[model samples]
Target: MRGPVSEGDWRGVVRDVRVTGHRVTKRATHGRDKLLREVAWLKALPPKAVGYFPRVLEVRTGEGWAEYDMDFCPWPDMSRVLVDGTLTVDEAISGTRSLLGFAFDVLYADHHRPAPEDFFHVSYVDKFWRRASAGRGMSERFDRLCSAEQLDIHGRVYPSAASLMRELQRDTVLLARLRPPCLGRFHGDFKYDNVLFEPATGRFLLLDPRGSTVTGDSDSDYMEDLAKLRTCTRGLYDLVRAGAARVSEGEGRISWEWASWAGPALQRFSALDAWLVDELSVKARARRDADWRVRLDVLMPLLLLANAPFQLAPVNPRTEDIALVLHATGVRLLAEALELHGTRDLGVSP
Candidate 1:
């Protein structure tokens, strides 16, 4: 099969060219219209933010399937950088600094003024429940796991998943309380693996981005991006994806056992939570934003919970039952975060 050749461009279609190299085709096989939004966002990127993202070479669509072809970076993504056991700690830190620069300068650049967006509604309630009730009982496993009295995952105690969900659901004021600093030009799905490093060009490029159709009414909110980054640092998204977590039921409770994350890149990534808080604090103080930590704390677990359903129905390969473990972990984390911070941030205390 021959790929669509552009004027004066060298290209050929290799059958089943799913692996990334020079150019890659992203197909929304589930009729989700993800490619449409991705193409839209790629086009919407500021002209100045050129090198931060790949160039869109082609877009093709059909009934129940949409796809687009774009340049693929040669470097490993941040997720791989953290756990693939190749890059050293120093190398990971330096590369991560560059990744942040590229991401903030372009992919998550604040292009619009602040708006009182109901960030909670978008980040937590909408993303999570949308899947739980999205026709299939995709998230029911999470519900089952959470129904336990308590969760002990990797030696950490957490509230029951159902309990956390009920508390978060009951907090009506918090749902309408989140007002983000800016609401323009967000990457949609700004997670670790989606970011790539191009060595020869010293560029940190972004891959998958959530289309507007996938999220809220518009493409904005860097908080989601921050939450995703935190998902790696704190939520341990890459670690979980790497099959480091195990799930089990015992003595009337669900528990998780984890392998030690001794990879070279993880030592550095694991310590970044404090640094993230300090960095966000400095920025929030500069912005005169009060209770930024509270907001982030609230946002983090929501992002985790929102991400749970997708894990249950992952497109990439995953360890068997990792999705349930991920959901259980999110529930635990949410229970922990809300318990520590309390519901004052939500404008009501329980």
Candidate 2:
């Protein structure tokens, strides 16, 4: 018998997750397509050489939704570990090394050379403007905040959240130079949220991957994965998502604060990222990949810009306050990223 059709809203749950014997079933009630993507990516495993990732058991698609089941992993994901302070610095580093080993040793490949040169311009820059424009047209509040040239967030002045990206895009040639030196089959959304680490056995599992890479349906820049991880670490994404943030509007400006938190979790994450940056920087220079590091720098914040617009959408009023924090985070980081490369202003409109 057919069940009652869903409006696609989960009310609160993205899936109806349950454990049946040794298997875990994730029946999608929202964002079903996302689950489908995960299923497809997971089904195409990277072998057992690098240890664990979810093993897709079965996938089911319906009239307007999808669901899948996989091996049960009782361990906490990196996000929960970060919040609970369970994941230690050593574990973080070790787990990441193992993950990257898999990527480097197995996933690295040559599907395309040097990308399209306009990869960033097309993938990130265009999508950012399109999302922001549509988002601003959704609400006057979003319109005002998104339309502003400069914003004072946490008492710090930043260029508009979406504008700096446009500024970077103003000079297409420069955007063309932002490609990472190495291209490979990538875990498009590689971040803490997608990683599950078990401290006891020292085994980690990655769940939920984008169906394909950013630049294509097959391969992508390796730095894209690194940038996504940096978003959680140096970008304080986990901190901000944990409600360790404040946002308010007044005096014709919006203010967003990545407020204080007690503990070593955030600090530990920052350290991990710092280590990654230092290590990668040396190798980038050795390869004479002038744009490699800069591309990574730019990608870190472009990731935020890629998703910030969804927060601005009027779909759920509950996520409204989060919009500003996301906006400011991207803007501030984009400015800093551009500065690191000595990238000059392209005279993009305020």
Candidate 3:
């Protein structure tokens, strides 16, 4: 039997034993009350969803524990595939493209005009802003980093987080002009481990859709998977390793270890993303293409910013410093991306 695996929000206790002769059981639990909500949503999925997720065999709820049993998926976990070094660039690109394409097709198959609330559900932005601005040390470091007039952020210079934030907000406004006519259904959580791929069938099984429903905010769901995918695949593990090192060294200052490890991965991810966006633009039209590009530009930074805290908060004390550095990195990336095209788009330079 596999021991418990803990991520940010939930701990999954997996049992290798079968419910009958062939069915394995997994008991997923959360320290908070969220597990039951996820269970409820999993149980309520329409039959069509079974093709993209595991089949739920049973469910139970109690005071401090929530659990569910599902057929053990035989497909390979995508994260393991990546970690094992067997994941090719083509495979990574295909897997994400196929899975996201399928989700969009299913969710938008019968779409009409987007719900009115979709246009205004910018809560994701606000949520990330709150988290990114919350850590004093990280903010202080970010302030220090930005104080350098020569601080090169991907070839652009940001004088301060304030200037960066202003540029990001400005880009947000520009990208807002090219929204899709209607909001469609999307996977709220599409991390790699949450996705299972069957090589033989060229199909993907998506797990753990956000169990909660948001009225009129479906637009936020768009490309949410891509944002998370880029984060996890590109930098999360490096940040984790960096944090572990910082803890071991007992220093919170920025170190070469982070850049040494995460730098290449981040670069690779950027190239991959550019390739994907280009491929998608050719397949979709100009408007849809622009929306996806904008999502990569604006929405991804927000997602990364919001996730920085969640990633850092649950670790032991030693790792807190690492988390702070990681958080600062996310903010730095956000600022850099916001200023990528410079202020020419806004008719001014900062």
**Quick one: best TM-score, which candidate?**
2
Better of 1 and 2 by lDDT: 2
lDDT, candidates in the order shown? 0.61, 0.67, 0.51
Local lDDT at 100 for model 2 = 66
- Ranking the candidates on lDDT from highest down gives 2, 1, 3
> What does candidate 1's lDDT look like per residue over 1-350, in tens digits?
11221111001111122646677877665533445756877877778776677788888877766777877667888678667756555555566567655666655556465554555555456655654444134344555554556666555666655566667667665444456656666676667788776444456777776645233345455666776778777787887788876667654346666666545445667666666667767655765666566667766776666556555533333533566666665766676667665553422122
Query: What's the residue-level lDDT of 55 in candidate 3?
Result: 71
Q: Which prediction has the highest lDDT against the true structure?
A: 2
lDDT of 2 at 200: 65
TM-score of 1: 0.80
Give the Å error, residue 154, model 1. Answer: 5.3
TM-score of each: 0.80, 0.83, 0.69
Which residue pairs in candidate 1 have backbone atoms (N, alpha carbon, C) closer than 3 angstroms, thus clashing?
none
- Model 2: what TM-score? 0.83
Q: Kindly report which residue stretches of model 2 are placed more than 4 angstroms away from their true locations once superposed.
A: 1-16, 29-34, 46-51, 109-113, 137-141, 213-216, 251-263, 282-289, 312-318, 346-350
lDDT by residue (140-191, candidate 3, tens digit) is 3443443334333333333344454555555545445324455555556667
